[model samples]
Target chain A: MRDGKDDAAPRARRRFLKLAGLGTAASGAALLAGSGAAKAAAPAATEAAKGYRVTDHVRRVYDLARF
Target chain B: MIAPEDQGRAYLYRLLARLLAAAPDAATLGLLRGLGGDGSPVGGDLQGLAGAAATAGPGALEREYHDLFIGVGRGELVPFGSWYLAGFLHEKPLAHLRRDLGTLGLGRTAGTKEPEDHVASLCEAMALLIEGKGDLGAQKAFFERHLEGWAPAFFADLERARAARFYAAVGRLGARLMTLERDGFAFVEGVAA
Candidate 1:
Protein backbone atom coordinates (compact mmCIF):
# COMPACT_ATOMS: atom_id res chain seq x y z
CA MET A 1 0.00 0.00 0.00
CA ARG A 2 2.80 2.38 0.81
CA ASP A 3 4.46 1.67 -2.54
CA GLY A 4 1.11 2.07 -4.31
CA LYS A 5 1.15 -1.65 -5.26
CA ASP A 6 -1.85 -3.81 -4.40
CA ASP A 7 0.16 -7.06 -4.90
CA ALA A 8 1.96 -8.06 -1.61
CA ALA A 9 4.66 -10.28 -3.28
CA PRO A 10 7.50 -7.71 -3.26
CA ARG A 11 6.79 -6.67 0.35
CA ALA A 12 6.68 -10.29 1.51
CA ARG A 13 9.96 -11.06 -0.30
CA ARG A 14 11.60 -8.03 1.31
CA ARG A 15 10.48 -9.12 4.77
CA PHE A 16 11.68 -12.68 4.20
CA LEU A 17 15.10 -11.48 3.07
CA LYS A 18 15.40 -9.17 6.07
CA LEU A 19 14.55 -11.99 8.47
CA ALA A 20 17.03 -14.38 6.85
CA GLY A 21 19.81 -11.81 7.03
CA LEU A 22 19.10 -11.17 10.73
CA GLY A 23 19.07 -14.86 11.45
CA THR A 24 22.49 -15.37 9.78
CA ALA A 25 24.07 -12.42 11.61
CA ALA A 26 22.75 -13.69 14.96
CA SER A 27 24.14 -17.20 14.29
CA GLY A 28 27.52 -15.72 13.31
CA ALA A 29 27.68 -13.82 16.58
CA ALA A 30 26.80 -16.97 18.50
CA LEU A 31 29.51 -18.95 16.73
CA LEU A 32 32.11 -16.30 17.54
CA ALA A 33 31.08 -16.25 21.22
CA GLY A 34 31.12 -20.05 21.40
CA SER A 35 34.67 -20.21 20.02
CA GLY A 36 35.82 -17.53 22.46
CA ALA A 37 34.39 -19.43 25.39
CA ALA A 38 36.07 -22.63 24.18
CA LYS A 39 39.42 -20.86 23.98
CA ALA A 40 39.02 -19.48 27.49
CA ALA A 41 38.18 -22.95 28.83
CA ALA A 42 41.26 -24.59 27.24
CA PRO A 43 43.93 -23.14 29.56
CA ALA A 44 42.02 -24.31 32.61
CA ALA A 45 42.23 -27.81 31.17
CA THR A 46 46.02 -27.53 30.76
CA GLU A 47 46.25 -26.33 34.34
CA ALA A 48 44.45 -29.45 35.46
CA ALA A 49 47.08 -31.45 33.57
CA LYS A 50 49.79 -29.90 35.74
CA GLY A 51 48.25 -31.45 38.85
CA TYR A 52 49.34 -34.94 37.80
CA ARG A 53 53.00 -35.34 36.97
CA VAL A 54 55.97 -37.63 37.45
CA THR A 55 57.46 -36.33 40.68
CA ASP A 56 60.51 -37.33 42.73
CA HIS A 57 58.26 -39.44 44.96
CA VAL A 58 57.07 -41.46 41.96
CA ARG A 59 60.64 -41.85 40.73
CA ARG A 60 61.78 -43.28 44.05
CA VAL A 61 59.11 -45.94 43.84
CA TYR A 62 60.16 -46.72 40.27
CA ASP A 63 63.79 -46.97 41.42
CA LEU A 64 62.92 -49.48 44.10
CA ALA A 65 61.19 -51.63 41.54
CA ARG A 66 64.35 -51.73 39.45
CA PHE A 67 65.62 -55.31 39.81
CA MET B 1 31.23 -47.91 17.40
CA ILE B 2 31.44 -47.00 21.06
CA ALA B 3 28.15 -45.73 22.40
CA PRO B 4 28.53 -42.43 24.20
CA GLU B 5 27.54 -44.02 27.52
CA ASP B 6 30.27 -46.66 27.25
CA GLN B 7 33.02 -44.04 27.38
CA GLY B 8 32.56 -43.65 31.12
CA ARG B 9 33.33 -47.34 31.62
CA ALA B 10 36.51 -47.00 29.59
CA TYR B 11 37.55 -43.97 31.61
CA LEU B 12 36.96 -45.76 34.92
CA TYR B 13 39.07 -48.70 33.82
CA ARG B 14 41.83 -46.33 32.81
CA LEU B 15 41.63 -44.50 36.11
CA LEU B 16 41.84 -47.71 38.09
CA ALA B 17 44.84 -48.80 36.03
CA ARG B 18 46.66 -45.54 36.66
CA LEU B 19 45.87 -45.50 40.37
CA LEU B 20 47.19 -49.02 40.67
CA ALA B 21 50.39 -48.24 38.78
CA ALA B 22 51.89 -45.54 41.03
CA ALA B 23 51.41 -43.42 44.11
CA PRO B 24 49.39 -40.26 43.55
CA ASP B 25 51.09 -36.90 44.09
CA ALA B 26 49.70 -34.21 46.37
CA ALA B 27 47.73 -32.57 43.57
CA THR B 28 46.45 -35.92 42.42
CA LEU B 29 45.58 -36.71 46.01
CA GLY B 30 43.56 -33.50 46.24
CA LEU B 31 41.59 -34.38 43.13
CA LEU B 32 40.73 -37.75 44.64
CA ARG B 33 39.74 -36.01 47.85
CA GLY B 34 37.29 -33.88 45.91
CA LEU B 35 35.25 -36.75 44.50
CA GLY B 36 31.67 -36.98 45.81
CA GLY B 37 31.02 -39.92 48.10
CA ASP B 38 27.70 -41.75 48.36
CA GLY B 39 26.27 -45.05 49.60
CA SER B 40 27.29 -47.10 46.55
CA PRO B 41 30.10 -49.64 47.02
CA VAL B 42 32.26 -47.94 44.39
CA GLY B 43 31.65 -44.62 46.05
CA GLY B 44 32.61 -46.08 49.43
CA ASP B 45 35.83 -47.51 47.97
CA LEU B 46 36.63 -44.18 46.36
CA GLN B 47 35.99 -42.42 49.65
CA GLY B 48 38.25 -44.92 51.40
CA LEU B 49 41.01 -44.29 48.84
CA ALA B 50 40.56 -40.56 49.27
CA GLY B 51 40.73 -40.85 53.03
CA ALA B 52 43.87 -42.96 52.83
CA ALA B 53 45.49 -40.39 50.58
CA ALA B 54 44.46 -37.52 52.83
CA THR B 55 45.68 -39.21 56.00
CA ALA B 56 48.86 -40.80 54.65
CA GLY B 57 50.07 -38.05 52.30
CA PRO B 58 52.06 -38.61 49.12
CA GLY B 59 55.22 -39.61 50.95
CA ALA B 60 53.47 -42.36 52.88
CA LEU B 61 51.69 -43.55 49.75
CA GLU B 62 55.00 -43.77 47.92
CA ARG B 63 56.48 -45.79 50.77
CA GLU B 64 53.45 -48.02 50.82
CA TYR B 65 53.61 -48.61 47.07
CA HIS B 66 57.29 -49.42 47.41
CA ASP B 67 56.68 -51.86 50.20
CA LEU B 68 53.60 -53.49 48.78
CA PHE B 69 54.63 -53.67 45.12
CA ILE B 70 58.42 -53.29 45.16
CA GLY B 71 59.88 -55.02 48.18
CA VAL B 72 63.53 -55.92 48.66
CA GLY B 73 63.23 -58.89 46.32
CA ARG B 74 59.54 -59.18 45.51
CA GLY B 75 56.41 -57.35 46.50
CA GLU B 76 53.74 -58.93 48.67
CA LEU B 77 51.54 -59.34 45.55
CA VAL B 78 52.31 -60.34 42.00
CA PRO B 79 50.13 -58.26 39.67
CA PHE B 80 50.25 -60.53 36.70
CA GLY B 81 47.66 -62.45 34.70
CA SER B 82 49.98 -65.36 34.14
CA TRP B 83 50.54 -65.84 37.83
CA TYR B 84 46.88 -65.63 38.61
CA LEU B 85 45.93 -68.07 35.89
CA ALA B 86 48.68 -70.67 36.03
CA GLY B 87 50.48 -70.21 39.38
CA PHE B 88 53.46 -68.49 37.74
CA LEU B 89 54.36 -65.44 35.71
CA HIS B 90 55.05 -65.82 31.95
CA GLU B 91 53.12 -69.06 31.80
CA LYS B 92 50.63 -70.29 29.22
CA PRO B 93 48.22 -67.54 30.14
CA LEU B 94 50.77 -64.89 29.36
CA ALA B 95 51.40 -66.51 26.02
CA HIS B 96 47.71 -66.55 25.28
CA LEU B 97 47.36 -62.90 26.27
CA ARG B 98 50.29 -61.95 24.08
CA ARG B 99 48.71 -63.69 21.09
CA ASP B 100 45.42 -61.95 21.70
CA LEU B 101 47.10 -58.59 22.18
CA GLY B 102 48.98 -59.12 18.95
CA THR B 103 45.76 -59.87 17.16
CA LEU B 104 44.29 -56.72 18.61
CA GLY B 105 47.31 -54.77 17.33
CA LEU B 106 48.32 -53.58 20.77
CA GLY B 107 51.78 -53.73 22.26
CA ARG B 108 53.59 -52.74 25.41
CA THR B 109 54.58 -49.13 25.75
CA ALA B 110 58.15 -48.34 24.88
CA GLY B 111 60.76 -48.17 27.67
CA THR B 112 58.59 -50.11 30.07
CA LYS B 113 60.21 -53.26 31.40
CA GLU B 114 57.11 -54.73 32.94
CA PRO B 115 55.64 -57.82 31.34
CA GLU B 116 52.64 -57.49 29.03
CA ASP B 117 50.49 -59.50 31.40
CA HIS B 118 50.59 -56.87 34.14
CA VAL B 119 47.09 -56.17 35.45
CA ALA B 120 47.47 -52.41 35.00
CA SER B 121 48.49 -52.79 31.37
CA LEU B 122 45.60 -55.12 30.60
CA CYS B 123 43.13 -52.64 32.00
CA GLU B 124 44.68 -49.92 29.86
CA ALA B 125 44.31 -52.10 26.78
CA MET B 126 40.65 -52.74 27.54
CA ALA B 127 40.11 -49.02 28.00
CA LEU B 128 41.59 -48.36 24.60
CA LEU B 129 39.49 -51.07 23.04
CA ILE B 130 36.28 -49.68 24.46
CA GLU B 131 37.25 -46.13 23.51
CA GLY B 132 36.79 -47.05 19.81
CA LYS B 133 39.81 -49.03 18.70
CA GLY B 134 37.61 -52.12 18.96
CA ASP B 135 33.90 -52.72 18.82
CA LEU B 136 31.73 -54.52 21.34
CA GLY B 137 32.54 -57.94 19.94
CA ALA B 138 36.26 -57.35 20.23
CA GLN B 139 35.82 -55.98 23.73
CA LYS B 140 33.90 -59.05 24.85
CA ALA B 141 36.44 -61.39 23.34
CA PHE B 142 39.38 -59.66 25.01
CA PHE B 143 37.68 -59.53 28.39
CA GLU B 144 36.64 -63.16 28.28
CA ARG B 145 40.00 -64.37 26.97
CA HIS B 146 42.32 -62.22 29.06
CA LEU B 147 40.64 -60.58 32.03
CA GLU B 148 37.65 -62.68 33.08
CA GLY B 149 39.84 -65.68 33.81
CA TRP B 150 42.00 -64.13 36.52
CA ALA B 151 41.54 -60.41 37.25
CA PRO B 152 38.76 -60.87 39.80
CA ALA B 153 40.92 -63.21 41.82
CA PHE B 154 43.84 -60.81 41.59
CA PHE B 155 41.67 -57.97 42.88
CA ALA B 156 40.41 -60.17 45.69
CA ASP B 157 43.99 -61.01 46.61
CA LEU B 158 44.92 -57.34 46.50
CA GLU B 159 42.02 -56.47 48.79
CA ARG B 160 43.25 -59.05 51.29
CA ALA B 161 47.00 -58.49 51.02
CA ARG B 162 48.71 -57.68 54.28
CA ALA B 163 50.43 -54.60 52.85
CA ALA B 164 47.25 -53.16 51.42
CA ARG B 165 45.98 -49.81 52.71
CA PHE B 166 45.14 -47.32 50.01
CA TYR B 167 45.49 -50.12 47.51
CA ALA B 168 42.84 -52.10 49.31
CA ALA B 169 40.38 -49.41 48.32
CA VAL B 170 41.79 -49.52 44.83
CA GLY B 171 41.27 -53.24 44.91
CA ARG B 172 37.65 -52.81 45.83
CA LEU B 173 37.08 -50.32 43.05
CA GLY B 174 38.85 -52.56 40.56
CA ALA B 175 36.77 -55.51 41.71
CA ARG B 176 33.56 -53.58 41.24
CA LEU B 177 34.61 -52.31 37.82
CA MET B 178 35.53 -55.80 36.70
CA THR B 179 32.13 -57.03 37.77
CA LEU B 180 30.49 -54.24 35.82
CA GLU B 181 32.58 -54.95 32.76
CA ARG B 182 31.71 -58.63 32.97
CA ASP B 183 28.03 -57.93 33.31
CA GLY B 184 28.09 -55.37 30.54
CA PHE B 185 29.77 -57.83 28.21
CA ALA B 186 27.27 -60.53 29.13
CA PHE B 187 24.38 -58.17 28.51
CA VAL B 188 25.69 -57.33 25.08
CA GLU B 189 26.16 -61.01 24.28
CA GLY B 190 22.68 -61.77 25.48
CA VAL B 191 21.19 -59.10 23.24
CA ALA B 192 23.13 -60.44 20.28
CA ALA B 193 22.03 -63.99 21.01
Candidate 2:
Protein backbone atom coordinates (compact mmCIF):
# COMPACT_ATOMS: atom_id res chain seq x y z
CA MET A 1 0.00 0.00 0.00
CA ARG A 2 2.91 2.35 0.65
CA ASP A 3 4.42 1.98 -2.85
CA GLY A 4 1.00 1.83 -4.55
CA LYS A 5 0.64 5.65 -4.56
CA ASP A 6 0.43 8.27 -7.32
CA ASP A 7 4.20 7.98 -8.11
CA ALA A 8 3.98 4.16 -8.44
CA ALA A 9 1.41 4.46 -11.25
CA PRO A 10 3.62 6.75 -13.36
CA ARG A 11 6.74 4.62 -12.74
CA ALA A 12 4.99 1.40 -13.82
CA ARG A 13 3.77 3.13 -17.02
CA ARG A 14 7.32 4.30 -17.78
CA ARG A 15 8.73 0.80 -17.22
CA PHE A 16 6.14 -0.71 -19.56
CA LEU A 17 7.02 1.82 -22.29
CA LYS A 18 10.75 1.13 -21.85
CA LEU A 19 10.18 -2.65 -22.01
CA ALA A 20 8.08 -2.24 -25.15
CA GLY A 21 10.87 -0.23 -26.84
CA LEU A 22 13.46 -2.89 -25.91
CA GLY A 23 11.23 -5.68 -27.22
CA THR A 24 10.84 -3.87 -30.57
CA ALA A 25 14.60 -3.33 -30.83
CA ALA A 26 15.27 -7.01 -30.05
CA SER A 27 12.72 -8.16 -32.63
CA GLY A 28 14.18 -5.82 -35.28
CA ALA A 29 17.69 -7.15 -34.65
CA ALA A 30 16.46 -10.76 -34.94
CA LEU A 31 14.57 -9.94 -38.12
CA LEU A 32 17.65 -8.32 -39.65
CA ALA A 33 19.76 -11.37 -38.83
CA GLY A 34 17.13 -13.67 -40.26
CA SER A 35 16.93 -11.57 -43.45
CA GLY A 36 20.71 -11.74 -43.83
CA ALA A 37 20.65 -15.51 -43.45
CA ALA A 38 17.91 -15.75 -46.09
CA LYS A 39 19.85 -13.53 -48.46
CA ALA A 40 22.93 -15.69 -48.02
CA ALA A 41 20.82 -18.81 -48.62
CA ALA A 42 19.65 -17.57 -52.04
CA PRO A 43 23.04 -17.67 -53.80
CA ALA A 44 23.70 -21.17 -52.50
CA ALA A 45 20.40 -22.33 -53.96
CA THR A 46 21.26 -20.87 -57.37
CA GLU A 47 24.50 -22.86 -57.46
CA ALA A 48 22.81 -26.25 -56.98
CA ALA A 49 20.95 -26.37 -60.33
CA LYS A 50 23.77 -24.59 -62.10
CA GLY A 51 23.04 -24.54 -65.86
CA TYR A 52 20.20 -27.05 -65.66
CA ARG A 53 17.35 -26.11 -67.97
CA VAL A 54 13.73 -27.05 -67.40
CA THR A 55 12.58 -30.33 -68.96
CA ASP A 56 9.54 -29.56 -71.13
CA HIS A 57 8.92 -33.10 -72.32
CA VAL A 58 5.93 -34.89 -70.91
CA ARG A 59 6.73 -37.39 -68.20
CA ARG A 60 7.89 -40.73 -69.59
CA VAL A 61 7.68 -43.91 -67.53
CA TYR A 62 10.41 -45.86 -69.29
CA ASP A 63 13.91 -45.46 -67.97
CA LEU A 64 15.87 -44.97 -71.19
CA ALA A 65 18.95 -45.89 -69.24
CA ARG A 66 17.28 -49.13 -68.23
CA PHE A 67 17.60 -50.29 -71.82
CA MET B 1 19.47 -56.06 -81.76
CA ILE B 2 16.21 -54.12 -81.75
CA ALA B 3 13.07 -55.97 -80.69
CA PRO B 4 9.46 -55.75 -81.85
CA GLU B 5 8.29 -56.27 -78.30
CA ASP B 6 10.09 -53.04 -77.50
CA GLN B 7 7.17 -51.06 -78.84
CA GLY B 8 5.98 -47.51 -78.05
CA ARG B 9 9.44 -46.09 -77.65
CA ALA B 10 8.21 -42.82 -79.06
CA TYR B 11 8.71 -41.57 -75.51
CA LEU B 12 12.43 -41.79 -76.06
CA TYR B 13 12.11 -39.87 -79.30
CA ARG B 14 9.88 -37.33 -77.64
CA LEU B 15 12.46 -36.92 -74.87
CA LEU B 16 15.16 -36.36 -77.47
CA ALA B 17 13.11 -33.78 -79.36
CA ARG B 18 12.41 -31.96 -76.12
CA LEU B 19 16.02 -32.10 -74.93
CA LEU B 20 17.16 -30.77 -78.29
CA ALA B 21 14.45 -28.16 -78.70
CA ALA B 22 14.55 -26.89 -75.13
CA ALA B 23 17.32 -28.42 -73.01
CA PRO B 24 18.12 -31.44 -70.90
CA ASP B 25 16.07 -32.47 -67.90
CA ALA B 26 16.67 -30.28 -64.89
CA ALA B 27 16.68 -33.53 -62.97
CA THR B 28 19.85 -34.56 -64.77
CA LEU B 29 21.54 -31.29 -63.73
CA GLY B 30 23.68 -31.16 -66.89
CA LEU B 31 25.66 -34.23 -66.06
CA LEU B 32 26.73 -36.30 -69.10
CA ARG B 33 25.73 -39.63 -67.63
CA GLY B 34 26.22 -42.50 -70.12
CA LEU B 35 23.18 -43.11 -72.41
CA GLY B 36 23.74 -45.86 -75.00
CA GLY B 37 22.20 -48.29 -72.59
CA ASP B 38 22.10 -51.55 -74.48
CA GLY B 39 22.18 -54.67 -72.34
CA SER B 40 25.74 -55.07 -73.55
CA PRO B 41 28.16 -52.74 -75.26
CA VAL B 42 29.83 -54.00 -78.41
CA GLY B 43 32.22 -51.05 -78.87
CA GLY B 44 31.01 -48.42 -76.42
CA ASP B 45 34.35 -47.04 -75.26
CA LEU B 46 35.67 -46.22 -78.70
CA GLN B 47 32.31 -44.94 -79.80
CA GLY B 48 32.06 -42.74 -76.71
CA LEU B 49 35.52 -41.36 -77.45
CA ALA B 50 34.75 -40.60 -81.08
CA GLY B 51 31.44 -38.93 -80.34
CA ALA B 52 32.53 -37.02 -77.21
CA ALA B 53 33.28 -34.08 -79.49
CA ALA B 54 29.62 -33.49 -80.38
CA THR B 55 28.35 -32.66 -76.89
CA ALA B 56 25.64 -30.05 -77.32
CA GLY B 57 26.71 -27.45 -74.78
CA PRO B 58 27.24 -24.23 -76.74
CA GLY B 59 28.43 -24.11 -80.35
CA ALA B 60 30.36 -27.38 -80.43
CA LEU B 61 27.46 -29.60 -81.49
CA GLU B 62 26.23 -27.22 -84.20
CA ARG B 63 29.76 -26.96 -85.58
CA GLU B 64 30.06 -30.72 -85.50
CA TYR B 65 26.77 -30.99 -87.40
CA HIS B 66 28.06 -28.48 -89.92
CA ASP B 67 31.30 -30.36 -90.33
CA LEU B 68 29.47 -33.65 -90.56
CA PHE B 69 26.79 -32.44 -92.96
CA ILE B 70 27.01 -28.73 -93.86
CA GLY B 71 30.66 -27.88 -93.40
CA VAL B 72 32.69 -26.47 -96.29
CA GLY B 73 34.94 -29.48 -95.84
CA ARG B 74 33.60 -33.02 -95.77
CA GLY B 75 32.10 -34.24 -92.52
CA GLU B 76 33.37 -37.19 -90.53
CA LEU B 77 30.14 -39.15 -89.94
CA VAL B 78 27.75 -39.28 -92.92
CA PRO B 79 24.57 -39.73 -90.74
CA PHE B 80 23.11 -41.98 -93.39
CA GLY B 81 23.14 -45.77 -93.91
CA SER B 82 22.88 -45.42 -97.67
CA TRP B 83 26.03 -43.30 -97.77
CA TYR B 84 27.89 -45.93 -95.80
CA LEU B 85 26.20 -48.94 -97.47
CA ALA B 86 26.15 -47.99 -101.12
CA GLY B 87 29.15 -45.56 -101.11
CA PHE B 88 26.79 -42.73 -102.09
CA LEU B 89 24.29 -40.49 -100.35
CA HIS B 90 21.12 -41.65 -102.09
CA GLU B 91 20.70 -45.32 -102.95
CA LYS B 92 18.29 -48.26 -103.03
CA PRO B 93 17.51 -47.91 -99.35
CA LEU B 94 16.05 -44.50 -99.99
CA ALA B 95 14.19 -45.60 -103.10
CA HIS B 96 12.82 -48.51 -101.16
CA LEU B 97 11.80 -46.13 -98.43
CA ARG B 98 9.76 -44.18 -100.96
CA ARG B 99 8.20 -47.32 -102.41
CA ASP B 100 7.36 -48.52 -98.94
CA LEU B 101 6.07 -45.04 -98.24
CA GLY B 102 3.66 -45.41 -101.17
CA THR B 103 2.51 -48.76 -99.87
CA LEU B 104 2.03 -47.31 -96.41
CA GLY B 105 0.44 -44.21 -97.89
CA LEU B 106 3.03 -42.07 -96.11
CA GLY B 107 4.37 -39.13 -98.13
CA ARG B 108 7.51 -37.08 -97.85
CA THR B 109 7.19 -33.47 -96.96
CA ALA B 110 7.34 -30.90 -99.80
CA GLY B 111 11.09 -30.57 -100.39
CA THR B 112 12.72 -32.47 -97.59
CA LYS B 113 15.11 -34.77 -99.44
CA GLU B 114 18.09 -35.45 -97.24
CA PRO B 115 17.41 -39.13 -97.95
CA GLU B 116 15.73 -41.66 -95.66
CA ASP B 117 18.96 -42.48 -93.90
CA HIS B 118 19.23 -39.09 -92.29
CA VAL B 119 19.19 -39.37 -88.50
CA ALA B 120 16.05 -37.28 -88.23
CA SER B 121 14.42 -39.38 -90.90
CA LEU B 122 15.52 -42.49 -89.08
CA CYS B 123 14.04 -41.06 -85.93
CA GLU B 124 10.85 -40.26 -87.76
CA ALA B 125 10.81 -43.79 -89.14
CA MET B 126 11.31 -45.24 -85.70
CA ALA B 127 8.50 -43.10 -84.38
CA LEU B 128 6.27 -44.33 -87.16
CA LEU B 129 7.28 -47.86 -86.34
CA ILE B 130 6.48 -47.42 -82.68
CA GLU B 131 3.07 -46.03 -83.55
CA GLY B 132 2.36 -48.70 -86.23
CA LYS B 133 1.77 -45.91 -88.72
CA GLY B 134 3.12 -47.74 -91.75
CA ASP B 135 2.84 -51.35 -92.91
CA LEU B 136 4.43 -52.69 -89.76
CA GLY B 137 5.84 -55.85 -91.29
CA ALA B 138 7.50 -54.22 -94.32
CA GLN B 139 8.70 -51.30 -92.24
CA LYS B 140 10.08 -53.75 -89.74
CA ALA B 141 11.91 -55.57 -92.49
CA PHE B 142 13.27 -52.34 -93.93
CA PHE B 143 14.44 -51.23 -90.49
CA GLU B 144 16.15 -54.54 -89.82
CA ARG B 145 18.02 -54.59 -93.12
CA HIS B 146 18.72 -50.93 -93.74
CA LEU B 147 19.01 -49.29 -90.34
CA GLU B 148 20.14 -52.04 -87.99
CA GLY B 149 23.64 -52.36 -89.36
CA TRP B 150 24.78 -48.81 -90.11
CA ALA B 151 22.66 -46.65 -87.85
CA PRO B 152 24.49 -48.03 -84.81
CA ALA B 153 27.77 -47.07 -86.44
CA PHE B 154 26.53 -43.56 -87.06
CA PHE B 155 25.23 -43.22 -83.50
CA ALA B 156 28.48 -44.58 -82.10
CA ASP B 157 30.39 -41.95 -84.02
CA LEU B 158 27.94 -39.33 -82.87
CA GLU B 159 28.28 -40.35 -79.21
CA ARG B 160 32.02 -39.87 -79.28
CA ALA B 161 32.12 -36.89 -81.61
CA ARG B 162 34.31 -34.06 -80.37
CA ALA B 163 31.26 -31.85 -79.90
CA ALA B 164 29.16 -34.54 -78.26
CA ARG B 165 28.12 -33.67 -74.72
CA PHE B 166 24.44 -33.03 -75.03
CA TYR B 167 24.50 -34.83 -78.36
CA ALA B 168 26.36 -37.68 -76.70
CA ALA B 169 23.29 -38.21 -74.60
CA VAL B 170 21.23 -38.04 -77.78
CA GLY B 171 23.54 -40.56 -79.42
CA ARG B 172 23.24 -42.78 -76.42
CA LEU B 173 19.47 -42.61 -76.61
CA GLY B 174 19.60 -43.37 -80.32
CA ALA B 175 22.01 -46.23 -79.89
CA ARG B 176 19.94 -47.69 -77.09
CA LEU B 177 16.82 -47.39 -79.20
CA MET B 178 18.58 -49.13 -82.06
CA THR B 179 19.59 -51.96 -79.78
CA LEU B 180 16.01 -52.30 -78.61
CA GLU B 181 14.74 -52.37 -82.16
CA ARG B 182 17.42 -54.75 -83.34
CA ASP B 183 16.75 -57.19 -80.53
CA GLY B 184 13.02 -56.91 -80.99
CA PHE B 185 13.40 -57.77 -84.67
CA ALA B 186 15.74 -60.59 -83.85
CA PHE B 187 13.23 -62.04 -81.41
CA VAL B 188 10.58 -62.02 -84.10
CA GLU B 189 12.97 -63.71 -86.46
CA GLY B 190 13.80 -66.29 -83.81
CA VAL B 191 10.21 -67.16 -82.78
CA ALA B 192 8.83 -64.41 -80.56
CA ALA B 193 10.76 -65.65 -77.55
What is each model's TM-score for chain A? 0.24, 0.24
Candidate 1's C-alpha runs over 4 A off are A1-67, B1-4, B190-193
What digit string (tens of lDDT, one per residue) describes model 1 on residues B1-193?
3333354455456566666666776867776665544554445555676676667688888877777766666677767677677765556877778788778777544444456776767876776676556766677778888888889988888888898888887787778767766755544433221
- The digit string of per-residue lDDT tens for model 2 on B162-193 reads 75555665677567656655654442322211
User: What does DockQ come to for candidate 1?
Assistant: 0.02
Compared with the true structure, model 2 gives a TM-score of 0.52
Best by lDDT: 1
Question: What lDDT does model 1 reach?
Answer: 0.59
What lDDT score is found at residue B130 in candidate 2? 45
Worst 10 residues of 1 chain A by lDDT: A25-34
Regions of candidate 2 where Cα sits further than 4 Å from its true position: A1-67, B1-8, B14-60, B134-139, B189-193
- Complex DockQ per candidate: 0.02, 0.01
